[model samples]
Target: MQLERGVRTVKLKDLPEPKPRPSTEGMTRITGRGTSMLQSKPLINIVNVVASATIDQRLDLKDVQKKFPELEWNPDLFPGAVFRLKSPKTATLLFSTGKMVCTGAKSEKMARNAVKTVVQKLRKGK
Candidate 1:
């Protein structure tokens, strides 16, 4: 089929109607366990929320690893210790510089909770 740009053209077969596109007009952030209330299907779903925090003092990665055996730490391979939480299902990277980067959280509240949990566990070891 050839379509003319400037001039008019005619075809024997009628043109089919264009399909309606999925709308994201009423889309908003999800709250609690339920999804956003929209006329059409949800256009967005939050898979991961990354958050960062820092402490005042330096962290002893070696001692932290020893204290929390569940924490995965290999200074030779990676400088940060991976501390995973079960409740929020988040992985927080703990560095010697007292810096923390949390990932795999569904929401900001969940990310904050995950970081708080990790900090509490670290403090308990001291």
Candidate 2:
């Protein structure tokens, strides 16, 4: 009898380390929709997920910008902006609304955690 075998390959790239943004708790508010009394808060919009691994990996802003030119890839403003996660195997998405959608997360907890982290950062203005 004969047996079949399969092989997988992995590649390494020089990606940038995750850079956490500053806290945004006391940051000034940015004008948004609604009446003047209703001010809008600042937030991060993470998008795309090219690849990820068990261990945390770095993300290439330039590459991501090249891919999604529409998005405003501002490292200074929203650093630590990652679309993919290692353990959860998930990707984040942003929309015009003040909400984010996390896709591909292994479990609900991962998705919630991702959103919570982002929200906390936004609240902190980081």
Candidate 3:
């Protein structure tokens, strides 16, 4: 049906009102687990590890920086030393207290490798 512009064919009150929600008293919860077609492991992304060690004495960041080419340290800005490694790829932070924080490792194996690499390098540096 064609109507003239700016005209109401039906009254606003004539429109049907929304029905109220049904009561939940008659409902029953499903007790059994549902079957699944997909059998894939859950995605576990972004794993990080923070570790510490107690050295015999306070570690010198400058010395670590000088020894490891991959290490970056600026005593004027921060007291921590950073060693970044590729291959299972992670960045480890070394502090004067012999504390270390390893981040960016995808899995526990990668984190262990990163920590082991750092410890091995530090041991060799001594």
Candidate 4:
């Protein structure tokens, strides 16, 4: 027996209409244990680290890799990007996720200040 090898045909009229999605205004109830409480206010958390300098221009994958040899700087995997700067006493790691962890910083204030500066710069750029 010989099998046919050709393009198949279908009529558009035979197709069914696509289902409509729920409206945005509708209330979405949560049933999970962790999120039992209703979130009346906005949930605020850090998610981006703003650098003082223009990050896209000043920082790159190679720069981060060179400064922090410990971290594997894969731009593709970490799409947000990372910035590393080092002084005589301190080394700072700023992630796209609004969190900066500093090592060898002179003081806690210095580390906090650095993160604040970066956050300001990022916001200004945006």
Candidate 5:
């Protein structure tokens, strides 16, 4: 069938070089090769995670301010309302556009829990 779809050419380079093994025992073995080994887990602490959410309804900052007087809202400085939680220890930003930004959580799990707490509070009102 058409000469089995034509023929192809191949080339092989000549082996012309030789290298010596490392003199150290660590390098010769499979493990403990300098500081290049990969660890099973990372070695740092989780401190902060920023998360966002968009609500379907719009918000009124003036009404929200009256409802939650503890929340800090300075229209001259910033547009969003700043709410700080003591439980998970996170600072959340609530916008009138029904958007939220949460930060300063110790871990991913904590960050998610903090966001849930904020939403629950918003739904339940002050």
Candidate 6:
């Protein structure tokens, strides 16, 4: 079979017989007289997740900032307003076109929750 690009073709019969590996099921490898090498499980963690969403209707950033005094919006620095939530610990960017980008969430569910929470807070401003 051709395994790689610009390489020679390997025939099935030309290959040496594969040796069977010793089963290590429920057993550890002994390196020293009393020391055994045990396989370790990998550590994995979800640190951050980013999610974006769009509201159909156009938004008035000034009006939103007026209603929610806690929202940070400076036209000179950025066009989007920063809405921060403490529960899911996320910051969502709100634009005049009604587009939102939520960041600093730990997982997909937390990202969705943060977006939904921001939407709900905006709805309450009306």
Give each model a TM-score: 0.66, 0.31, 0.56, 0.30, 0.63, 0.64
- Residues 1-126, candidate 4: write the lDDT tens digits: 333336655555555755536542344446686465343454565434332322343444364456446554566766534433443233455555434555544555665666555455445542
- Residue 98 of model 5: what lDDT? 93
Winner by TM-score between candidate 2 and candidate 1: 1
Q: Which pairs clash in model 4?
A: 47-98, 48-98, 50-118
Higher-ranked by TM-score: 1 or 4: 1
lDDT of 6 at 13: 64
Tell me the whole-model lDDT of each prediction, alpha carbons only.
Answer: 0.86, 0.48, 0.72, 0.48, 0.78, 0.87
Candidate 4 is scored at a TM of 0.30
The CA root-mean-square deviation of candidate 2, after full C-alpha superposition on the true structure, stands at 26.3
Model 1 lDDT vs. the true structure? 0.86
Which residue ranges in model 2 land beyond 4 Å of their true spot?
1-89
**Greater-TM-score candidate between 2 and 3:** 3
lDDT of 5 by residue, 49-109 (tens): 8988777778788888887888999989999999889999998999999999899987888
Candidate 5 lowest-lDDT run of ten: 1-10
Candidate 2 lDDT, 1-126, residue by residue in tens: 333334633333333545535663344545557433324355755444322222133444465456555445466766534444454555565432333556665455666766665444444533
Which residue runs does candidate 3 get wrong by more than 4 Å?
A: 1-57
Score residue 60 of candidate 2 by CA lDDT. Answer: 49
Every candidate's CA RMSD: 10.1, 26.3, 12.6, 14.5, 12.3, 10.8
lDDT of 5 at 107: 80
On a 0 to 1 TM-score scale, where does candidate 3 land against the true structure?
0.56
Which candidate comes out best when scored by TM-score? Answer: 1
Residue pairs that clash (backbone atoms under 3 angstroms), model 1: none
lDDT of 6 by residue, 39-119 (tens): 755457879898999999899999999998989999899999999888989999999999999999999999999999999
